[model samples]
Target chain A: MVMHYPNGQPYRTKQLSLKKSPYPTATLYGNRGMTLEEEINESNQYYLKQGIAVIHKKPIPIQIVNVDYPKRSAAVIKEAYFKQPSTTDYNGVYKGHYLDFEAKETKNLTAFPLANFHAHQIEHMKACQKQGGICFTILRFTSLKEVFLMPASLLFQYWDNQQANNGRKSIPYEIIKKQCAHITYQLQPKIPYLTYVDKLLEQIL
Target chain B: MVMHYPNGQPYRTKQLSLKKSPYPTATLYGNRGMTLEEEINESNQYYLKQGIAVIHKKPIPIQIVNVDYPKRSAAVIKEAYFKQPSTTDYNGVYKGHYLDFEAKETKNLTAFPLANFHAHQIEHMKACQKQGGICFTILRFTSLKEVFLMPASLLFQYWDNQQANNGRKSIPYEIIKKQCAHITYQLQPKIPYLTYVDKLLEQIL
Candidate 1:
């Protein structure tokens, strides 16, 4: 049966579910409209092709409970469940520096919520940061058509504050605009995120 | 239905298939009959606990299809297929340096076969190497009870030579014994692989 929104527009469950997909799908046209992960993946591919960087979105972890093997055919997974990943969704090497990050999207114009990140993911990023890997988050305000690369250190401050008794649940949009590295979209590479990563590298070195 | 091997021992299809499973399974014993991936995972856990290094096995890439979303219950994947990975199996950061590697085990005592590696994996490693990321392969001779970390540069040489006509199909056991850094199994970490990675770091530095 087809579903509809309360406003009378048709609801697309498949597209909604696929938008949460962990892997990138192919796009035939220029960036007409894509999710944050898709944009980063395309930019990563461009960087890889140009020999500027080597990065990839890690595959979603699935726990397989049962599989079927038939004669003269490939094995088919009959039962499985999505397993939670211990690390962030994206990681790779760039110019001899280890880069790690998580991408997030939100429609709210006032702020980006901290609940979008998991506690374990925060711990993982903290561990990577201790190892000197450049860690950050790619934040996209889709309604505002803006993106920012916020360093992990700044994020930890907010996270720790929220864990305390009285802390704000979200980061103000004005704060992100002032503190983070804003990435302008481009034609060839789409996101041009590494330009900001290079900036982070300069600060570190 | 039960089957038997040539030596009259009952065949364990599940264990045989599980041996080829990509993700590591838990073990209660102290390095008692674990696969190469399991040992590496255990050692990675130890390293993570000790703040020595941060490494993880990339989850197996799965192409999920036809999920059933029952009300008030977790979604169950009804059908899916395994997708070939474009890069190596294991990668992470160790002391500010990027590490990438593929782990393989063989029963042949003479050599490790080149067929075990995919063409795109070699290309991925080359891309990583050009970016100055540390790349290598973890090879375990199951029958010989030996493990070695062979540099990706060496593996690439063999790979390219084999691509040309009249090249040997495997790296000779003697060459690997002489060229690669051998890892000793330990009780605490199970397989102390990163000690050799530190050695490789010494050479690179």
Candidate 2:
């Protein structure tokens, strides 16, 4: 089903279909057609139930201007505007470590655009890192049908380079595949991203 | 303005008039009609702008079951339900300290109702305290026209008492005034609750 915004614009679901080949497909369930946000939200619920992590998507901040009060019981928001959020999408605690991250999907097969990220989000991640929290980004390459957990440190390098007039504003897909670890999905755990986190923790320790 | 929930119930706004008259009558304007939530939010923005702290109110969780897409840029949520939140309203950092709090207001002239809080919220606060974070509740008595920064440790005692069949489920206004520090508002820092935080930190240190 297609979703339209208030302005009647179609909302794009970042669901990529994997090519059926002799080799194992990198994308998980090409037919499910679930958006990245929905899948991640489900994964978070799974994580919460298993007593693993308690990450959650921050609600889209809206400036509520007017409301209609029909009765003493119910209040209906009559007018509101979406406000730009100053932080990343998800945050919570995992194994005594504060986890924060942003997930983005790109259709380009060769590179992932840096413009998908906001300056404030990058600054927030930097602050989180300074506070000894685990910060990262999940980048999904739709054309290649692959997803990788890229550390915020690596992301900052590209972000800083872009400010310094770097040749390209996107990180090449090859670099991500080689440097970052892949998160697999399981029945109970759903998003097995914590396994990669365990590895990152091991390296940090 | 009236805001209605999805269930067609009018959302109740906590009134903020005080009756005890501790300070001068002129100061009563500051105490009139401002919710504990609104005060704390303004305080947080003050803290953020000064680089003194970084705290934010978490978004209300909602479960969207269906959506209608009319265009590629917007997704109108057609069917959604509010989900129970598992954490406190506000959380972030202040001087390398993890700060967490829940803001509550009561209209009772004699006491602050314990029922204004939830079991899960108390549990979350306890958990954060166990992890060495500063957790507290900013309580406002609208009828009494007063606000108090009650620590989680003190709050837990009252919460525990309620479960033990204590007939009194509310904290007396006199007890709050004696035990917890009262917050005064400033021009820039509207809530000025962090002044109480400084005292708490001193005691902890």
Candidate 3:
């Protein structure tokens, strides 16, 4: 059995990032040993340092039950539990637009399972959309090594259909390929999704 | 021994929110026994529910060092520590603009101390401001029960002055009153800050 983080990254992958890469500057796909979250984090760092954007992954929510304070050391949390996030994983300002997104990679090559998303996340995105925020998903088909930036508006259609029991449990890859902007991974940014965000802004605004 | 959360919220004040108020709907100033965080959360809830804005307080960041997974039970975080946040407390979208802010309450009557802010938070806000996001601080004078929304641009002037070792360590109450927009406590939203955000939008844009 494989454990997974609340954000949907595999628990085993956490250690992979710690392992020093033989080729740290590898631009080749699948050679970097980087998870989607790590790649995005690197990209965010690049964007921030380059003065391109200011995006951040919201820290995982934890319910601290007990804490211990030593004589002179930093306080230690003795007991706590992960709390389900009420919103998406990532959000920040980008070129005057409110950018919000969740990144998920699926092993399934044919369809992206809707189980990766929670109802609250969809609802949160809808509320954000109503407020004119640029909401979307950074979805990756891991086996295929393909990624796409799917607009929240397009996501809502599938979500509503699923909720109404009017569609399949997963979105077919074909539809995703049609409706979403395919993002190619790059060395500098890892994932140049913001270029698509610029396209999204033009269409929506 | 006073305990403070990483966000600067008092530990004792945490229990105050759980107490059943005799006058739940009391509009009297400081009679509700609510902290500035609680009030801002209430206002964000109101805004989110009313489709007014999609603001939310980022959860306090924690670094999980160990976890215990018992049989058929939720994974318990056995070891963790509070991490200094890299960004402001509250951030989200309002009418297409990215809104970022930190909320701090001062007991001092004469001035709001600059010590409440972290350097990284100021740096983050400056970056957001560069992206054309509406960044500010929601300052509360707890003793006087006054709230003010000071724009980040104005804050930079004072922050830079202090950093240069050429100015006072605190912004005087009179200066805050003059430079910031005063916000009044209200029943529904608790803190009617967005009304001033609209005005801010007009001025900035």
Clashes per candidate, residues 3 or more apart or on different chains: 0, 29, 0
lDDT of 2 by residue, A121-191 (tens): 89888876776777898777766767788999889999989988765798888888888887765675556
**CA lDDT of every candidate:** 0.79, 0.68, 0.80
- Give the best candidate by lDDT: 3
C-alpha lDDT of residue B68 in model 3: 68
How far residue B7's Cα lies from its native spot in candidate 1, in Å, is: 30
Ranking by DockQ: 3, 1, 2
TM-score (C-alpha, index-matched) for candidate 2: 0.73
**Residue A171, candidate 2: C-alpha displacement in angstroms:** 1.7
Q: Which ten residues in a row have the lowest lDDT in candidate 1 chain B?
A: B24-33
Candidate 3 residue A37 C-alpha distance from true site, Å: 0.8
Of candidate 1 chain A, the 10-residue stretch with the lowest lDDT total is A24-33
Write the residue-wise lDDT of candidate 2 on B1-205 in tens digits. 5554442233444452333444333223322323566667788878777766667887655444444433333324554434456687787766556677888777788888777777888877776665567789888787766778998887888889988877579888888888898877678787888788889989875
Q: Tell me how each candidate scores on DockQ against the true complex.
A: 0.37, 0.19, 0.37
The TM-scores that each candidate's chain B achieves against the reference are 0.84, 0.82, 0.84
- TM-score winner, 1 or 2: 1
Per-residue alpha-carbon lDDT of candidate 3 for residues A4-75, written as tens digits (9 for 90 to 100): 544333355536434554432211122222378788988999999988899999887777667675645666
